[model samples]
Target: MIYAFLNQKGGVGKTTLSIHTAAELSGRGRRVLLIDADPQGSSLAWSNYREKANFTVVGMPKATIHKEIDLLAQDYDDVVIDGPPRVTELARSIILSADIVVIPVQPSPMDVWAAAETVDLVREAQVYKPEIKCCLVINRKITNTAIGRDVRDALAELEVPVLKNDIGQRVAFAESAASGSTVLNQKLSKAAREIIKFVNELRRLK
Candidate 1:
């Protein structure tokens, strides 16, 4: 299965989630392959932080994606891609190649607009692959805030099925990214459990 973490806007924790998702699946006994389609290379650098890692994340340019996929095809059970900003052809390719596309958005108007464009991009890709599964995930949410409720309502009213699990803002997530460890490695954080549950549901969908 292939999953892409995407958002047009920056700082929505797309790469962070992508790395963690790859780690969680790898820990769960899946041979996970991660492709950092973004030129920023956050995922790739994070993957390199660990002296040894069970999963791998590679940085690949947009033009040679198909070739890279061919090389890694037989070596892994699942592929998770971290895509760049939306105004690029690379993100489209990532979406097209995914079995499931996960869009992570902040509970704010600007992020919502970014996610809207991403949703349309995914929809347009249906011409090439009509069976793709796409879903929205509200990330970096603040509980008891009106913004969180608004994001949930807006997505639901638009018929977008938001994930039942939400990613709360936590320092463990940041530390995990810097050290190439997932929240699953954080041991006792609530956010870690939410990330695990959310990714498990994503696995079930596949």
Candidate 2:
């Protein structure tokens, strides 16, 4: 399965979610491929810092995504794409290349708008990749915000299948990414548990 973590805005935990999801999948003995489609190469840099990881991090930039991703899917059980942080043509191409696209939205109005835009793009791409699946993920959520609840509720109102677990705002997510360790490799935290739950949900979908 191919999962693309994407959003139009930066700082929404797109790459963080992608990397941790990849780590969780790999830790469960799945052959995972972490594709760093982001030109920033956050996932690739994290993989380099970790030195040893359960799966391979392929920092392939924007390219002939269709052919490349098709060939890549041949070897890995799961392909997680850390796409560029903008809902442009490149990101849509990546989404179309994916079997499933996970739109990571931070618990904020702006992020929600960005996520909505990305989802719109994905919907438009459905004219092409009709079988591709796109889902919304509330990343960096706060516990008390009614606004957060509103966002989640709105997604539910739209009948979108949201992962029950939400990745909270955490320093651990940044710490591990900076150090090239996944949240799973770091000390256990709410973020790690959310990621684990997410991986489990994704596996069940497969």
Candidate 3:
């Protein structure tokens, strides 16, 4: 399976989610590969920083990713693409190649509004790849905050379904990412548990 983490807006935590999700799957003994489709090479940089990565991480910033991904997918149990933050040909190619697209939306009105463009691209891709699943996961959420609740409610008005498992604004995420480690490497952290739950939910999707 191939999963693409995408959102047109930056600072929405797409790279963080992609790296963590790939790490989680790889830690579970799945043969996972992470493709850094973003021109910024965030995922590639993270992988380079890691002394040892359980999964393969590559930088493929070309618009022809849709054509290149299939050959690469044959060797891995799962492939996760960290998409670029613009509605460009590269983003479309990533969406077209994905089996599932996870859009990370921050808990704010601006973020929600920006996500609509991504949702639109997903819908357009679905016209061809009807089996391609798309969902929104609220990233960097603040627990017990009214803005969080409001954001969740507002997402309901969007065309895509929002995942029940949302990631809170935890320091662990930043610390782990900076050190080229994942939340799963931490001993009993809430961030780790949240990521595990979200990955499980994604696996359950047909």
lDDT of 3 by residue, 104-156 (tens): 99999999998998999989988988999999999999999999999989999
Sort by TM-score, best first: 3, 1, 2
Tens-digit lDDT track of model 2 for 12-117: 8888888888888888888999889888988887887995768988877675675678888889888889888763877867877888888887776777667777
TM-score of each: 0.93, 0.92, 0.98
Clashes of 1: 0
Worst 10 residues of 2 by lDDT: 153-162
Ten contiguous residues minimizing lDDT sum, candidate 1: 63-72
The top-ranked prediction according to lDDT is 3
lDDT of 3 at 8: 92
Q: Using lDDT as the measure, what is the rank order of every candidate, best first?
A: 3, 1, 2
Choose the strongest candidate by TM-score: 3
> How does residue 40 of candidate 1 score in lDDT?
84
Candidate 1 structure quality by residue, lDDT tens digits, 10-111: 888888888888888888899999999898888888877874679877887484564456566468899988888754588777877788989998898888
